[model samples]
Target: MAAAFLPPSLITVIWGFIGIVCPLFAKGPNKGIIQCCLMLTAACCWLFWLCCYMTQMNPLIGPNLSRHSILIIAKEWGNEITNTTTT
Candidate 1:
């Protein structure tokens, strides 16, 4: 959906600017090192943030039900199981 893609697009643009544009302004003998550091930092931050965002959108874990819990719930909630016979 447009909603899902929009946030990532916006964030990527921001990070792209930080990594690509900010490096151009670096000065002195350590300019290359600064640029590399900025780009790597941007990339790592983007990757980590994207991973967390996707995980929140689709969780990896879920609740599990066992036979004991099912029976307990059925009894406490007054639910009855029925048997059907077909001839």
Candidate 2:
């Protein structure tokens, strides 16, 4: 069970490293854009890892919960807020 999460976690780490390295090599007017994209990607990767870590720790802290479900709920709530504010 624990082994299943390792691959995705490793992949996230790889992506984070890519995000960090990409901006350093970028040049010209697009450098800021590249850095912004990298920052956003890193932030998302960090959030994903945090959610997974929370889910893994749930067994010891509280009831077992699905990380996907939590993420879904958060997305829906964000969408709801955006929709309401746009009106």
Best by TM-score: 1
Candidate 1 lDDT, 33-57, residue by residue in tens = 9999999999999999999999999
TM-score: model 2 vs. ground truth = 0.43
Candidate RMSDs in Å, in order, are 7.0, 14.0
- Listed in order, each prediction's TM-score against the native is 0.69, 0.43
- Cα lDDT, all candidates: 0.90, 0.74
Looking at model 2, residue 15 earns an lDDT score of 76
TM-score of 1: 0.69
Clashing pairs in 1: none
- The residue-by-residue lDDT of candidate 2 on 1-87, one tens digit each, is 989688677877787787887778878888899898887888787778777877786555665668666667778787422224334
Each model's total of backbone clashes: 0, 0
Worst 10 residues of 1 by lDDT: 77-86
| C-alpha lDDT (0 to 100) for residue 73 of candidate 2 | 74
